[model samples]
Target: MRRLLPRNSLRSRLLGDLWKPLFCLLLLGAVAVFFLARHIGSSVYDRWLYDSAMTLAEQVRVEDGKAVLDLPKQAVEMFEWDQVDRIFSDVRSRRYGLIFRNSDLPPPPEELQPGQSRIFPHWVKGHAARVVAVAVPNPADPADVLVIQVAETMLKRNTLATDILVLVVPVLVVLALLVGIVVWRAVATGVRAVDQVVERLDSYGPDRLLPVGEITNAPAEVRPLLNAINQLIRRLSDLQDTQRRFIANAAHQLRTPLATLQVQTERALREPDAARHGQALSRVLKAVTRSRHLAHQLLMLARSEQSGEKALQMQEVDLAVLARDELERWIDSALQQHVDIGYDGPESGVEVYGEPVLLRELIGNLVDNAIRYGSVRDDGRRGGAVTLRLQVQPIMLVVEDDGPGIPPSERTLVLERFYRRRGAGGQGCGLGLSIAREIAQRHGARLVITDPPQGMGARVEIRFAR
Candidate 1:
C-alpha cells in the first residue's frame, strides 16, 4: 500500500516549496488591487457630482422667505452630459424642506455640515447610485437651509473600475510569472552542488575509489560523508592486498609438499627391493603428514579471519588451563626430540575471557614451534631449553626457547603468514606464529617477540591489558 504513494522529486519539490509562499503573496496583492481600484475610481468621479451640485446651488435664491432655483435648460443639461450615466438633483431647505427636485431622491444617509459635501451610496429606480449632499449657508433667506443633493447611476464608476482592472491585471500576472520563474531558478541553483556530487559518485567504481575527482563543488553538508567513504575505500584496499597475499602463500606452501609426495610415490612404485620400498613409503608418509598439517593451518587461518566477536566464545575460560592441556599433548613429542619442556605457573586456573579452543591452538602452536626449532640441531645435538611461564602480575603468558635467537630484522617478518627465515626448517609451514598472533589479537592481547632475559633464543610474549 505504501508503494502506491507518489514519491516527490527534489527539483519539483524545490520549485513547489518556493512557489507556494509567493503564490499566497500574489493572492494578497490581487485582493489589495481590487479594493484600490474600487476606491480610486469612486474618488475620481465623486468630484463631478460635487461640481454639478454646486452649479445648481449658484442659481438658487430666497423669495418671500422661500428658496427658488432659476435652473436653466443648458445649465441642467451639463449634469446629464455623461452618455452612460443617469443623473438626479434635489435642493431642499433644512427648515423649509422640499423646494426642488428631479426625482424623489432621499436625504443623504448622514447629516452634512456647512461647506462639507458627503457622498452616500444607495439604489435608485432599481439601479445602483452614488449620492452627494452639500450644506451651503443662504444669508438672504430666513431658513437655515441646505443647498443640494445629487444622485448618479454607477455606469461611469463601474466602467472606470473595469478599465483599471483590464490594464493592471495583465501586468500583474506577467510579474507573478516572472517572480515564480526566478524563485524556481533560485531553488535549482541552491541544490546544483548536490546533483553534481551524486553524478560523480554514480560514475565511480573500485578502480576509481580515491577522491572521486575532488568534489569541490559539493555542498559543505556532504563533505564529511565523502571523507568517510574515502576512509572505507582505503580499508577495503588493505583487505584486498591481504587476501591476495594469503592466496599466494597457501598455493606456494601446498605446491612444495604435493610435488614431494608425487616424486616419492613414483619412486615407491618403481622400487622392488623390500628395504628400499620401506624407505620410499616412509618418505611418502612424511610428505603426507606435512601436507595434512599445512591444510589444517590454512583452514584455521581462514576461520580466524571471520568476525572475531561472532566467532569467539564470550564465556570466561582459564588461559593457563588451556596451556596445560595443550602442553600435555606436546610433552611426549618434546621428550622424543630430546627437548626438555616444562610449565611454570600457579597450580590453579588463570581466568580470562576468550574461546578455549582457539587459545589451545595458540598455546599448542607456541609449544610445537619451540620443540621443532628450539633444542636439537640437524646433527642431533641438543643445546636449548624450552620453558612456558604464565605470569600473573599484569596477566601475561611467556614462551621462551634457548636456541639461536631470531635476528632483529626478521623477528617481525616471521609472524606474517608463510613468511620464513632464510634457514628455517621443515618442521613448520610458517603459519604457527601467524595463527598464534591472530588468536592473541582476537583475545585483545599483543604478541611480541623479544630476546629472552636468559640471553639467547626468542621469547614469544602474549601480554594482556589489565
Candidate 2:
C-alpha cells in the first residue's frame, strides 16, 4: 500500500484517508441502527396491541347466567386511528361462538380455548400486523372465560424508522466530513515547510554552498534529507577548491622548465664552439625531460582522482610479483644514484584485487621518490639502502629509506601536490607522494608515513583491510 503511492505529492496521497475507516463504521452502524430502530418500534406497537385486547376483554361480561357484550363502535374505530393502518378484533366465549370479528381477518393458528390466550404476529388481509389475545373471566361465572384478540398494521413503526434514519444519518455524515476537512488542512499546513525547501533548491547554483535558512524551521521528519543535501554542497565546494589548486600548481611547475629550455636554446644558437654548443644542447634536453616528467605526473594525478568515478577494472594478482617486477624496472635508476634498492619479500602468492598497470605505477612512484630524495643519509653521506618490504601479516606493504628522514611536521604536507617542506631540495615536482596516496586510496587501502623503528629514515606503510 505504501509502495503504490507516488512520492511527489503528500497532500493528494493522504487527503480523505479517513474515508476508509469512516466507511467501515458506516457499514457496521447501518446494521446497528436498523436493529435498534426495529426493536424500539416493535416495543411500542406490541404494547398498544395488548392494551386494546385487554380493553375488549373488559366488555365481555356474564350477566344472569349468560355472556353479554356492550362493545362501543367508537372503541373499535379508535384502533384504526392511522389512515395508513387497518385494525381487526375478535371475541369468543366458552359457551358461545364468535361474537365479533373482521370477516377478512385471518384466524389464529390454534383455537383460543377458554383460559388460554397468547400474543403473536400473523398476516391480516395480506398486510403484516402485531396481535394480542387474552382470556378474561366472566363477571358472574369465574369458571367460564372470554377470549379476545386484537391486531394492528405497522404504520407507526414505519414512520418511526423513517424519522430516526433521516435524523441520524446526516449527523454522522457531517461529522465525518468535518473531521476529514480538519485532517486535510493540518496535512497541508505541515508540508508547507517541505515546499519551501523545494523552492530554495529549485534556484540553487554552484556559488551558493551554504546551508539553507529554511531548514531550521523544517519539520523533524525531513531534517535528514536537508542535512544530506547540505553535505553534498560542502563536498562539491571542496572538489572545486581542489581543481583550482591543481591547475595553479601545474602551471607554476611547468613555467620554470619551459623558461630554462628557452634560455638554453638561445645560448646554444649563439655559441660557435661545438663543445659549448653541445653543453647548451644538453641543458636544453634536461629541461625538456623535466617538463615531460611534470606533464606525465599531472596526467597520473588526474587519472587517480577520477578512478573513483570510473570503476576499477580489477583482477587478482600476486602483489609480491608485481612489486618485484616494478623493482627491476627502477634498478638502473637506483644504481645511477648509488642507492642500494631491492625487494625484500616472497617471490609470489601475496594476492590482491587491483588494476595491474595502475598498481605498478603506484609502486614505481613510491620507489622512484625514495631513490630521488631518499638516497642521502642523515649524516649527509650518499649511497644508502632503500628497502621495499611486503609483509603478509595484516596484508601490508612497507617502504623504508635510510635517507634524511622527513620531519614530523612536513609528513602530511608532502602528500599534497607541489607542497615541499623546508630544506627539502630535490628534482621532484612534489607529486610522487600525492600520486601514491591517490592510487592507494583507490585500492581501498590506507597509507601512513612514519619513522622506522631505527629512527633514522622515513617508512611508508600501505595497509589493506581484509
Candidate 3:
C-alpha cells in the first residue's frame, strides 16, 4: 500500500535540493521578522493601552468610597488609530461589571484575567484579533478597580507581512540563481585546459613525438600528467634517432665490398684465354657468391634491428620437421663437397612459435657456417662428417661439424659480424653466426656456441624458449 506524505517533499536534483534548504531558511527568517515586528508594535500599543487605563484610573474618585470614572473621549479615540478594540470594566465590592466597551468582534472568554494575554485564530465575525487586557487599582480610592482591554484585528498585520515576503523572496531567489550560474561557469572554465590537452594528444602519431604545448590556464591537478607525457615523447624521439643512424652506417659500410666483387667479376669476364678465363671466372663467381651472401645477411640484420619486435609472424611449428626439410635441401651440396649431412630427432613433433622464414634462415646459417668452416682441418683432406640434430623434448637445434674445432677462447668472438677466425679459411663475409643470433633473439630463443660432445668440432645450438 502507498503511504501518504506531506505536501512539501525534499527529494529532488542537486540544484532543486539546494534551493529548498535555502528557501526554507529564508521562509523561517521571514516568519521571525514578522513576529519581531508584531512584538515591537504590540509592546508600543500595550504601553499606550496601559497609559489609557492609568489615565482612567486617575480619573476615578472615591465618592462614597466607590469607583467612578471621568474617562476622556480623546483617550478612546486613540484605540481607533491602530484599529485596536477596547473593553472597560469597573470592579466594585470585588465583583466585575462592564462599564464602556468598543469592539469589532465578540469579547474573549470570560475566564480571561487582567494583565494576561493570549493569541489565537478568531474565525468568528469574519476576522482575527490580537487581544490584551489589564486591570489596575482605582487611583482615587484604591478600593475600586478599573480594567482596560485592547485588541487589534490581525488582517492588517498579515497584509503587511505578505507584502514584505512578496518583495524579499524574489530578491533572495535571484541572488541564489546568480551565485549558481557563476560557480558553474567558473568550473567549466577551469576544466577547459584538460580538453585542449586531449585534443592535442588525439592528433599525435609515432613520427611526431613533439611535446604537447603547455596550456596557459591548465588546472594544477592535470599539470603533472602532461609533464610525464611530454617526457615520454622526448625519450622515444631520441631512441628513434639513434636507430636511424645505425641503419645508415651499417648499409654504407657493407656496400663497399659488394661493389668491389661486382667490378672483379666484370673484369674476369673480359679475359681472352679459355683456361685462364674459366679459372678467373670461377674465382670471380666465388667472390660474387660470397658478396651476395654477405649482402643478404646484412639486409636481414638491418631488418632485425630496425623492425623492433613485430617483424616475425610467430606460430606453433615442429622444429624437428623443419630440420628434416632443411637437411634434404642441403644434402646434394654436401655430397658435391664430399661431406656427409644428416638430421637426428625423435618421431614426435617438437613445437615452437616463430617466423618460419627467419627460423629457416637461422638453422641454415648455423649448418652452412659449420660446413664451410669445418671442411678444412689442420691435417687437411676433410676429416669427418657434419650432423644436424633436432632434439624434440627440449626443442634444441644443434649443428656440429667433425672438422678441427674452434678454440674455446674464440667461440664468443666468432658470433660478431664479419669477425672471421685467423686460421679459418673460408670465402665467407662472417655474418652467418651473427645473423643466426639475431634470428634466435627475435624468437625469444638463444644461440650458444660450445665444443661438440666428442670434442672434435664446434657445436652450435639454438635453444627455443619453453
Candidate 4:
C-alpha cells in the first residue's frame, strides 16, 4: 500500500520546505496592504465630511429668540448632493432640543464645544458611514452654541480600497511565482550533483576498483562521505592482493610434496624383490606423512589468519600445563631426529586468558619449528637441544635451542608465510613461525626473536600484557 504513494525526492522536499512559509508570508503581506489602503482612503474622505459640517455651521443664527439655520431649501439640497453617496446633516443646540435636519441623523454621544470639531465612524441604515461634528457660537446669543454634524456612506472609500487590492495582488502573485521557480531550479541542480556521484560509484567493477576522483564543484556537505568511501576502497584492494598471493603460495607449496608421494608410490609398486619392496613402501609412507603434515599446517595457518572477534573462544589457560603436554606429544619426533627437547617452567599452573586450542597450536608450532630447524650441526648431523621455558609477573614464554641462530636482519622476514632461510635442513614448509606469530597477535601478546642468554642459539619470546 505504501509503495503506491509517490516517492518524495530531494527536490520536492526542498521546494515544499521553502514554499509553505513563503506562501503564508505573501498572504499576510496582501492582507496588511489591503487594510492599510482602507485606512488611508478613510482619512481623505473624513476631511471632506468635516468641511461640510463647518459650512452648515455658517447658516446657524439666533432668530425669534431661538437658534435657527438660515439655509434655503435649494442650498440644503446642494449641500447634500453626492454622486455615489447619501449625506445626512443635523443641527442642534443645548438650549433647544432640535434646530434643523435634512435626514433623521443621530446626534454624537460626546459633547462638542465652540471652535471644536471631531470625526468618527458610525453605522447608518445597515451601511458604514463617516461622521464629522463641529460646534459654532450662535450670532444672536454668544453663550449658547450650535452643533452641526455631517455624515456620508463609505462608497468612495470602499471603491478606493478595492482598486488598490486589484492593482497589488497580481504583482504579489507574480513575485511569488518567480521565487518558486528560482528555488526549484536550485534544488534540482543540487540533486543532479548527487546523481553524478552515484553514477561514478556504479561504474566500478571488481578488477576496476579505483578510488573516486575529487570533484571541484561538489558541495561541501558531500566531501566527508567521499573520503570514507575512498578509505573503504583502499582496504578492499589490499585484501584482494593478499588473497591472490595466498592462493599462489599454497599451490606452489603443495606441488613438491604431492609429486614426491606419487613417485614413491610408483617405485614401491615396481619393486620386484621383497626386501626392496618393503624399503620402497617405507619411503612411500614417509612421503605420505610429510604431505599430510603439510596439509595440516596449511589448515592451521589459514585458521590463525582469521581476525574475526567471534572466532576466538577465550578462557583462562594454564600456559605451564599446556607447554608440558605439547612437549610430551613431540617427544617421539625429537628422539627420531636425535635431538634433546624438554620443558623448564613452574610445576604448578600459570594461568592466562586465551583460547586453549589456539594457544596449544601456538606452542606446538614454536616447538616444531625449533625441533625441525635447530636439530642440525656443521657436519650435517641431526642433534641439538630445544627447551620451552615460562616465567610469571609480567608473564613471558621462551623457546630456546642450541643451534645456528637466525641472522639479526632476517629475524622479521622469518615471520612471513612461506619464508625459509637459505640452506636450512629439514622437511619444513616454513609456516610454523608465521602461524605462531599470528596466534600470538590474536591473543594480544608480543612475539620477539633474539639471541638466547647462554650464547649461540635462537630465542623466541612471547610477552603477555597481563
Between which residue pairs do clashes occur in model 1? Answer: none
Query: Which segments of model 3 are wrong by more than 4 Å?
Result: 1-256, 307-312, 379-383
Per-residue lDDT over 389-408 for candidate 4, one digit per residue giving the tens place of the 0 to 100 score: 99887799899998888999
Global lDDT scores for all candidate models:
0.79, 0.79, 0.67, 0.83
Candidate 4 lDDT for residue 398: 91
In angstroms, give how far residue 433 of model 2 lies from its true place. Answer: 2.3
TM-score for all models, in order of appearance: 0.65, 0.72, 0.55, 0.73
Clashes of each: 0, 0, 0, 0
TM-score for candidate 4: 0.73
Model 1's lDDT to the true fold?
A: 0.79
Off by over 4 Å in 2: 1-8, 16-39, 50-70, 88-124, 128-151, 213-220, 244-288, 299-318, 325-340, 349-362, 376-384, 422-425, 435-446, 451-457, 463-466
Q: Which is better, 2 or 3, measured by TM-score? A: 2
Q: What does candidate 2's lDDT look like per residue over 261-348, in tens digits?
A: 9999999999999999999999999888788888989888877776755689989979999999999998888898789997888999
- Show pairs that collide, candidate 2: none
Instruction: In angstroms, give how far residue 267 of model 4 lies from its true place.
Output: 3.6
